[model samples]
Target: MKAVETAPHEYMANYVYSNSGLGAWFGAARLVDATGSKRGSFRLNGETWRVTLSYQESGLAPPEGGETPDGTRVDFDTLREFRLNAVVDDEIGERKVKALIQPRWYGLESESGKSVARPMWELGDAVNVRVNASNVEFDTVETAIQRAAGAVTLDPMYFDDRNEEYSVVMDAARYVRLDRDVSGPVHAREGPIARMGHLLESDRSGYRKIVQDDTERVGYYHTVTLGPKRVRECFPDHRIPKEFKHYYARNAESLPDDHPLAHPKVEASYQGSRWDETLRPVDHDELADELEEAVLATINEAGLPTQPLDDDGLGGGRTYVEDAYFEAKTVDRSRVLPLNLERVESDQRNVVVRQLANGLSPVEWDSLKTLVADGGDVSPAEIADEHDWHPDSVRRGLRRIEDMVVREQGSVALRSHYVAEQVVEALDAAREGVRNAMGTAANAVQNAERRSLDERTDELIAFCQSNGIHIDEREAQLRVRMGNLTGESWSELVTRLKRFWTAAGRDPERLKESVTHYRDEAGPKIRQARGAWTGGQTLQ
Candidate 1:
């Protein structure tokens, strides 16, 4: 299969979703020590896990029709006592943390000469709307009882949003974070295509709101920080801080389209495009195997694609034949992105030229200008000789120039494909004959007259037992290393050989004959089985 290309970055859920927080899962946790009135911020991965509980005092029971996605039976009374687990920390900047719910569409390519818009969505409607929440809290003053051993990760981000789609509270509570620790079980619906962040706590005390400023303070949206790539504040918090949203408040009138990121792109025409599609150059040894004498010899008539070559004509031709060649198209890797590199290098060179001017070094400029003219390939030694500068210093400048040039010239691979499969088969008979000869040499214990086999066997036993060994265990070890050796009674032969060595030796000549007998008996059978592995090649 051709390699799968990565989806665009916008489709990726960067690690740090908002407020430098690794988003948490809802309705997914277990208190290590469950006890009534035992409540505190359940720390997840050394970070605080926030739990939100709100209830109407007069409510005696949960409202009818209130059901968790998992069908977890609950009512208004149940919601009164809620527990949400969310990572909490100091989130500062122009806006509060929450998901920016913008309806997005992919594959909106233009055909003919017209344009089209894709679907849109409101954040948190289907998704957990967990809308970034404040860090976890404890109703009762107490420290976290159990230190979460591993990560407190959610089933993929969109999992909850997919669940409880048909439920009514989804719309009413479109922007509420779940108190999942107390939520119990929740089911996920797979049909919807949407995503949202939990509503995190606001700087203002008491009730918190979602951040949704599109224009002003958009830059304040959280950046994603994951892994070593330094994922920091990645997702845009839907909640907008009052002061920061002021910049774009007036501009919000022409939203969705007027949002800087939603600009219309005029795609260039693709008159006629061809790309390099070859996987890689083929191998040589694979082309060396012969097959006609092995499989075709059994054919008395034509095969499926056509009549098979007759047995009489099987072994007459050259070992192998391959005549077909392919036509491939490729991009000019050098020039396709030339301007990208040039612009980057120009910025760096301009800086170097300024440095030369600041020092008022006429000689330096002459040497540097000449080296620059040589492009990125110019050598450091050449620059040093031309500028009368030290080699080490010139080397550093050359490295900087090379880096600037490469950064300027972005590198991208040309994708391409080619098609073809050839017939390949090996003669197994030949392989077995070789194995038989090796086995015979190994069985000739009496041939070694100078040192007794029992002497060596004793030494082997001593070596293994010296390090704590049992007889059965040592025999099992020897059997494992036998790998792919051929013999109808190979296992029996090994047992007998070990036994004979433990006592007296056996005849060397008879051992040789046993080897010959094995090859003659199994060689042809092994050869016939080769096609069983590759499946007989059907010439079509």
Candidate 2:
């Protein structure tokens, strides 16, 4: 029988080809300076960077018994995997490195389930294949390593660019801001995500520090890592055939009749992305859904990068993966939202409180109250145990109020001291039967004010038009609002606008929306001053 390979790629592509935009991820093993010695330097992208060496000895024995025809011993008792990691910092930047890279070898197959030892010559061939498949200069990196380390065989190391984490380096220049509807542009802070600090009894290893380092400004990329063992424990209802583990282990043999992949429909789905197969045929959807759930559950799980790093944001380089989608020619850059850290303002906090009061169920309110009263750092399990509620129920309640909370080290807390105060105030008001009334009244007042502004803006536009001056509505509103905010006399503001149109080489007789665009392009400080048009009722 011909050796058959499993079509995991087809299933895997479903994840990569989904509707979601590619987020940055650090997918490589955390840089462990295992050897604690820096190798010689090399240049990359026209910058000099130092390389470090590390070797991890895998306890798992190498494939045994198979040997070359010449009778050299094939199996080794232990396998030592070497690693080379490199980093170069941004210019004059305090810490966050501009590029963190692990050299990759091209000519080697994945070391997934090889049952036999590879020939000794393949390592040299692999090195010759190039690091990152770049030009001759990069290839010299191998020669430099050979000269420094002396007779080291390069293992087939592969780095997937799509797995890199995006750390938005904070500096004086690229400060983040949010353009507001009412107040103006406000500065923001990026906080890291909380992660489980300890190991799970069932897991082998973990990356706790990396998970906790992920922040709103930093994208934490994750891929599906759940395999057969954990999947069976969590999702016993699904039809994950017992033979699934060994499916990839065997290269060419046809799957057993009882295996899910052995089914005709499952095989057909493998041929293309359009999986026409029904769920009942192989329970694929059920398995996929359960696997996805398990993946999410692993966010702070042990054996993954879920621990908080204690390095004070200075030491170490992160794994970076640039997504394959970014390389495509047809990407719509316009639709991409700028990824920036944003500060939640008092108004925003008020809005969230109002939304929560109006939207939360009684149980959600209870959860919020409990969180506030518990010193704001309790675990979800403790909250569930406190109320004797099912964990899912507790989670559902908390999810409804998640906007006002920040999670850290496997515990939850109100987002800030302000949020805590707001929660307490809201809770007190609720007891008095007026919790929602204040929020509602406030919203109503704001709406009325906006409506009044709209009416005045229309009157101002008409007033200007009658005076033989032409302007777009937005432009007119901005100018009037600018005048009001600045306390500029109405006449001086009008003269400035007329001059703006004249300077732009546009006649007042031919009004264009371009004036509004011009006003927006005037930059943040100018735009901030123009949100609400107010002042003299009569054209001055």
Candidate 3:
């Protein structure tokens, strides 16, 4: 065999390991020197190595596949010439070597005219694996590294003035990638893979290291013995989002069949119970409901990055959020309350109490009590009318009972008018306590709010009075300010706005009800704008 091709530097020591659990991982394998000053290190991702070399009694021995016969004294010169090319630090036989690397260790080059080092372990230490970092903190930097993933071409539209264009050294492997919420003057540590350690062929000009004598021999021997390997490695990193690892194997029907994420080939292999259930198709109507729910949840969750959508936060990224008709739909997940109150009383063994509400007279109370005792039941509406209490209050009181039962699954249920009445009484007590607290709280809150309101109103009124707003400046000067309200504040804002319109000689009510360019759709439009205003973007 050709000497250089089959040239092997047998390891002075051996490391043996095996996995009984059906798996073993070889992260990175490189034969490097002891002190890490020189190297013969080679990247061996998963490959095995075979080396044959002999320590000659001679001044210098070529590094190749040749076994040693114990006839020669360990010629330290020829012996130490074989360097480890596939290692990080210098090792003596089996001693561990410390390895420290920065992010830029991958981009170093050899100095020109540097002879290809045949020195063993010493050479591995001499190998250059430098990564030039332009200050990791982005200080004095208006422009920083950028990595654009999935883009076929670059666009400089976002840049304005002085330094506009961004350059990437393709040979240096300097690249930019997009990160979530990245915009405007970003700091260092913003770029992908901020720092790393390095090891290169000896001739390559790169980082230098201090090499001790003993380390030199050991490093040289190691490099000549083992080889090199290229493999992926874990590193200390800036925080990365879970979405970066979207393996996409959920029953998230939110992703359409045509979407890449939904394609069968794209999903990560998952064999959970949910996966088994996902295959069983529901009836058409049931499937429709499920699909609708999935869509609503997908859309709702898209606007909220904080709360996870499901166990797998891999479903999707955020989108603008807006909804038109927000009707309060009743969701009775459990049928806790039967239609009649008789079951409640019956269920409670008739110990359940009864009470009259809605202005029931003494006569009516007696009659209603007798009726309930005789196994009769009445709707909340009926009791409200009988007691002259507003049906709404009756309903609300009844709802408290309903809520308790529903919330606790019978941990506590209002079984009768007596039970419902007790619940209402407790609620009233709490409400009264709150009211008492409000009496004290009211002054402080009112004073603070008044001060704030005065300032805001003064600012708005002064600006409007100073400017030609709401009324003609040449005519009567006017100032408009909002007042404390007994009704909806938003509706009051409209009312005040109407007064402004009237002062300006326009129809007040019509203007308040106007569905013009920026009036009717303003609320939803503003909400949409707020949703879309990601980092560095604003409403304007």
Clashes of 1: 64
* Rank ordering of all candidates by TM-score, starting from the highest: 2, 1, 3
lDDT of 2 by residue, 38-71 (tens): 3544454565544455545433333225332333
Query: How many clashes in each structure?
Result: 64, 26, 82
The estimated TM-scores of all candidates read 0.16, 0.26, 0.14
Show where candidate 3 strays beyond 4 Å.
1-293, 296-540
Q: Kindly list the per-residue Cα lDDT of model 1 for residues 1-540, writing each as its tens digit.
A: 111011000000111112111122222222211222122234444445443222222122322354432343333232222122223333322111122111111211122322222243222212222222111121111122112112222223322222222111100000111111211111111100000011112111222222333343332222110111100111121111110010122443355632332221100111011111111102111111101111111110111111112234442222111111100111121111111211222222223222321231333334345433453334556667767888677545434333112211222110000000000000122124423322222222223222112344434333322322222111112211222334324344334444543442323323222211113233321221112233433121
Q: What is the lDDT of residue 300 in candidate 2?
A: 15
lDDT of 3 by residue, 430-495 (tens): 345533322222222232211012233233333333331222111122222222223333343444
Q: What number of backbone clashes does candidate 2 have, counting pairs of residues 3 or more apart or in separate chains? A: 26
Error of 3 at 273 (Å): 28
Comparison by lDDT, 1 against 2, better one: 2
lDDT of 2: 0.31
lDDT of each: 0.22, 0.31, 0.22
- Regions of model 1 farther than 4 Å from truth: 1-39, 42-129, 133-540
Q: Give the Cα-based TM-score of candidate 2 against the true structure.
A: 0.26
* Per-residue lDDT of 454 in model 2: 27
